[model samples]
Target: MEIIGFIAATLTTAAFLPQVYKTWKTKDVSALSLPMLLMFFVGVFIWLIYGYYKNSPSMIVANAITLCSAFLLIYFKIKYAKTP
Candidate 1:
């Protein structure tokens, strides 16, 4: 059960990578809306806070990675926003 939970968390959380990679490789955040990214970052932050409050290591780790990935999108949105 624990292994399954870890696997689920890892896979789902790692799902943010492809989008990040695309943004990194293409430097294209045009299709990525700023408000949407902001909302996602906020949601991830809330999930991290919830995980901390609940003392769930898996949740914390997963949310932390998610937050970082979302933040990367936000960063790219801000950095290369006007380009394309």
Candidate 2:
């Protein structure tokens, strides 16, 4: 069951990477909503805390990686907005 959780977490969390890569490669954020990104970052951070409380390795790992991507998106949004 825990293996299943880990697998599911890996798949779902990894799914965000392509978008991160695309954004990194192209640096285009005109289509991304800042509000959505902020919400996602906050939500994943909360999930990280929840995972710690519950002692869930899957949740922690997934949220940790996802948070990285989320932060990247936010960083790009801010950093790229200045480019003309």
Candidate 3:
């Protein structure tokens, strides 16, 4: 079960890397939604807390990495916002 958890964690966490890299390289956040990102960040934070309480290493690691990615997306969205 723990191995399954770790595998799932690795796959899900890996999924976010491409987006982060793309955003970093292109600096194009026009397609990104701030509300969605904020919601995801909050949800991931909650999951992180839950994982901590449950002592699930997989959850903790995955959520921590995902939270960071979400945060970076949010930051990029704000930083790259076009001023009217």
Candidate 4:
């Protein structure tokens, strides 16, 4: 069960990398919603805290990396937002 959890976490976490890379390369945030990224970052941060409390290595590692990715996306979204 733990192995399954780790595998799931790994796959889901890895899935986010492509978006981050695309955003980095394209600097195209027109399709990225600020509200969605903010919500995701908050959720991931909460999960990270919960992971620490539960001492779940898989959760901790997955959320930690995801938090970074989400944060990067949010940063990019803001940094590259077009001026009205």
Candidate 5:
């Protein structure tokens, strides 16, 4: 079951990478909401902490990756807002 959980986490976590890299490179954040990004980042952070406290590797990996991906989205939102 750990393998299945890892695969699921890996796929979902990886699924966001290409989009994040593309958006970061293009600096097109016009469609993103800062509040939404902030909320997600905070939520993911809490989940990461909870995962750590619970000693669940699956939760830890998934939440950590998600936090980073979400951070990228938030970063793009701020960094791209000034772009014309």
Candidate 6:
């Protein structure tokens, strides 16, 4: 079960890397929604807290990495937002 948890965590956490990489390299956040990113960041942060309380190493590690990626996306979205 723990192995399954780690596997799930690794896959889910890794899923965010491509988006992060693309946003970093392209500096284009026009397609990313600010509200969605903000919501995701908050949800991941809450998951991290829950993980800590639950003593789930897999959840902690996954949420931590995902939280960073989500935060980066949010930053990119703001930084690269077009001026109107």
Report lDDT (CA) for all predictions.
0.87, 0.92, 0.95, 0.94, 0.86, 0.92
Using all chains and alpha carbons, the TM-scores for the candidates as numbered come to: 0.89, 0.92, 0.94, 0.92, 0.85, 0.93
User: What ranges in model 4 sit over 4 Å off?
Assistant: none
What tens-digit string does per-residue lDDT give for candidate 5 at 1-84?
Answer: 677768988998999898898898888888788998898899989988997898788989998889889988987788779746
- RMSD in angstroms, candidate 4? 1.1
Ranking by TM-score: 3, 6, 4, 2, 1, 5
Pick by lDDT: 3 or 4, better one: 3
Task: Give a tens-digit lDDT track for model 3, residues 19-77.
Answer: 99999999989989999999999999999999999989999999999999999999999
Error of 4 at 80 (Å): 0.7
Model 1 clashing-pair count: 0
Q: Which is better, 1 or 5, measured by TM-score?
A: 1
**Model 2 alpha-carbon drift over 4 Å, by segment:** 82-84
Positional deviation of residue 17's Cα in model 3 after best superposition, in angstroms: 0.4
Q: Name model 3 segments beyond 4 Å from true.
A: none
Candidate 5's error at 14, in angstroms? 0.9
- Residues forming the 10-long window of minimal summed lDDT in candidate 2: 75-84
Better of 1 and 4 by TM-score: 4
Question: Which candidate's lDDT is highest?
Answer: 3
Cα shift from native, residue 17, model 2 (Å): 0.5
Clashes of 3: 0
C-alpha RMSD in Å of predicted model 2 compared with the true structure = 1.6
Per-prediction backbone clash count: 0, 0, 0, 0, 0, 0
**TM-score-superior candidate, 2 or 3:** 3
Q: Where in model 5 is the C-alpha error above 4 Å?
A: none
Q: Pick the candidate with the highest TM-score.
A: 3
Q: How do the residues 1-84 of candidate 1 rate in per-residue lDDT, one tens digit apiece? A: 456657877999878899999999999888999999899899989988998898788888888899899999999989987843
What is the lDDT for 73 in model 6?
A: 94
